[model samples]
Target: MTNSRPVVNKPEIDFSDPDWKRHFQEDFDKQFSLPHLRDILAIKPRPTTFSLKSRIPLDDGDGAATGSWNGYVNDDDRALLKVIKFASPTSAGAECIDPDCSWVEQWVHRAGPRKQIYFEPREVKAGIVTCGGLCPGLNDVIRQIVLTLEKYGVKNIVGIPYGYRGFSDEGLSEVPLSRKVVQNINLAGGSFLGVSRGGPSTSDIVDNIQAKRIDMLFVLGGDGTHAGALAIHNECRTRKLKVSVVCVPKTIDNDILLMDKTFGFDTAVEEAQRVINSAYVEARSAYHGIGLVKLMGRSSGFIAMHASLSSGQIDICLIPEVPFNLEGPNGVLQHLEHLIKTKGNAVVCVAEGAGQDYLHKSNTTDASGNVVLSDIGVHIQQQVHVH
Candidate 1:
């Protein structure tokens, strides 16, 4: 008897084989032929082209399109989706004016050549610290600067604690930054670094920056902070330390010069309006005649003036820049009387900076360690009620 052994021949398997294309094509066709995918692929691409006039057409009785349609034909059907897709990262899919919604066309007409970035990305080595009072968009400006710098392989960032106090002749209290640390910080209120009334006028601050060897310093604060950075810059330039100082203006007082619209001013205005509006309502109800509301501002009348303008109910506004004098017949007293007699009701907006020219000053200090503003509103209110 002869023992029979089964013959086994290995089936050839070659990933790089020429016939692999056919096999892969067959598998792809079969896998992608699922009912759901078939339905999606079956949809005829939507039309995106539209025509519009250079100007809006005048409305005649009949609603027929009639005008020099300005030859404004959108030839690029893919432009809208491309723009929308580009903006989606920042806008998060909010409605935008993109002409093309087709992903295929967008891919074809993309702005730049597609390539993978392979260089080991480096950090920004930049740091921002807040000082004094907190402000709005402090986090936003910090985040934007970080993000922009990050794209250029500079991502190393730190937040100096408690403003410049965090950085002193001793050293910088550093918080290492990464994509994870500052993510989604834009449009946030207050400062991520947290602010304090520390390091107002300290030479040790500049010494701290030098000791830490901070590549770039972004100071998120007000005039004092700006002055601190400026002083440091001057010293650095004088001694050649190569430290770069940039300032992001922020304050509730809005007194800082050069920059327009600091962070907290918007919030301050909204808050002041609420207070003024409520006071006006109460004045009307109590028949207290009028409420002379005092809003915050040391050197700037921005807050008080804005409150009156925004609160339409407030009949008159008084700012520090425009002094209130009662010695003459054409004084503020006469002005309020005129408004009361004509408007039936009056809500006056007065800046805290507007001192009492006729009355005595008070001995008080606010939370910021500044002298408290005298309440001219009370003096005016008293005199008006007496008369």
Candidate 2:
């Protein structure tokens, strides 16, 4: 009767038990309310309409209704038209009409017909110059330009060698193009027309154009090349000469302002994905190892983003748009260490321009006025080694 204390029983705990771990995870999930794959994949449907008046009128032999524009829309072109029609409109009072706007929805031939060349087909001397860096599908553009001009009945087409300099360089050569010369050129990569850096004065370029009697000039390059083309066009206009200037933007960087997607971008991303896969394999093969991959993206991180998303093998991705740290509790190095300690391996995909702020800057510029970037990949590798 004096010892009336209540008897108590203690609960036993086992850390190594699989059922204990599973129960712990279940409790954690219940407390945190983690998201499910089904929730992420569940996207709501939005209303869309594809109905539109046919842009291309029935082709009449005379072709008077269409003016200089050829009215032909393929299935792909029709699909693009629907996308343009459904896309968000530009802000009010915008100066330039959006390329995707309904007003510019008509699918016309890339080569011109709203404007006519001042010369006849045989007398029309056309010059094609490829400036800037290499890009995929350039040969295709060249071949198409040649064939289209041929369709327009132009026989004198010349390839300006080594970019805009071909216009003024005395020793630089020019290649005469024919249907046979460019027949199978598109089978290869790089520009068959060749490319170079820098250009001559605008007046000198205009003089060369006049000397060659080139009625049409097609400039294939990035913004820099387009600037040169604009200068040449202005000079020709000042001299009261009628020369049609066409620009086909080319850049593997894919940083153009208004363009949706540039040529060579898909190929670049595909190649990058292969590298990411290789990194993943290497990381998985080593114990507590980390594999890092660097991709091409000087000003924009499109390549890195696309590669990481496509491969689905990357543990972490760093881009220029998002700033990251190398030290501190929430830094990349800490995160990598945590990942390796927990999962035994980690993979990182970084863009070339991801960590510019962490490095010393250099006052270097390329021929196209692009600033030379520091090697972010090497810096990251060194930092990883130190940590």
Candidate 3:
């Protein structure tokens, strides 16, 4: 029998206790384990001469080529993505209570080329699709995947048009892909394969995959799109299909937990900053003027916060994470009154999803099923005019 319970749930063990190592290992092995295709397909992995084992390292600043690089990430090569709750998040001084578990610290795998691969490159048919709203660096990501597959000697590469719809829609067809076809795609915005919202059923998509004999599927999308991808993968797995599904998370909001940032976040922040700066100029030019700029951040406030920080001219920043009032004594209106009286003008930056309570909540959703947010910017403007 094994103690499969999380280490945090059990009584705290003394630091001097010799059994700490054994106890920690039990939780890590069972609770934080990652899955592998080798076990799923029950197939032995083959040694990969990925890019012929001679790919150039990113650090080679002098444009020097590497000879037979040995940079294949392995199972032992893991990282700490999910940090256990050693202490309450607010206790700044509290971190890693059980520091003695040194061996358990070497967890999670780094992203890179693996020394062993499951699929045969020449015979592999790779399919790529982009779903959800457009974001920065999508084309770059697509181009990179295509080039990497080409380097691995995969000749039959195809792009799925207009997201999951491509598989079911008769008008949408698979676009043949190659190195030459994707060569300057990175210079452009949006995806070469195009993007769309909620499309055909996962079962139908899998049917197409089986029909087309797609060996590997690469999905690029936001959180909702990622869930759809996982559902598709699970369906394929249940059918015992020999297909590998890979996803590259791309959210302009950068809301994914335990992950650093998402693609296009920087671009979103930079564009928001520019808008805030413009608002600042307009506010300062008028007498008792108010400049209001709204940024994109439906749930998270990374875009609004970062843009406000980057643009020094913003006097107030409203984010979705923080609830604010407009009419009370301590509300935004009162604050604006003070700023107008003292400073004569002020620039306020807000997230699109901020202060939703002040507006109507409709059950309506978008093409991707995301709730269409009420216009907080317009609401704020109207409130200011009324006051």
TM-score of each: 0.61, 0.71, 0.85
Model 1: per-residue Cα lDDT over 29-89, one tens digit each: 4643322212323333222112122122212212222354333232222222233333342
Error of 3 at 139 (Å): 0.4
> For model 1, what is the C-alpha lDDT against the true structure?
0.60
In model 3, which residue pairs have backbone atoms overlapping below 3 Å? 78-108, 79-107, 79-108
lDDT of 1 at 18: 56
Local lDDT at 23 for model 3 = 68
Output the TM-score of candidate 3: 0.85
Number of the predicted model whose TM-score against the real structure is largest:
3
Query: Which regions of candidate 3 are displaced past 4 Å?
Result: 1-32, 52-69, 82-107
lDDT of 1 at 227: 69
Which wins on TM-score, candidate 2 or candidate 3? 3
lDDT of 3 at 81: 47
Q: Could you report the Cα RMSD, in angstroms, for every candidate shown?
A: 26.9, 20.6, 6.3
Worst 10 residues of 3 by lDDT: 56-65
lDDT of 2: 0.72
Over the stretch 1-387, how does candidate 2's per-residue lDDT look in tens digits?
010111112134244454654554355346534222223243332211111223232222134333454443332332121122323345433222223332322221232232222345556799899998888889998998897777656779999999988887888878999789999999998889998878888888898888888888999998788888878877776676767787887878787654668888899989888888888999999988789999888867888888899999988899987898989999999999999889999999998989999998989988877788999889988998999
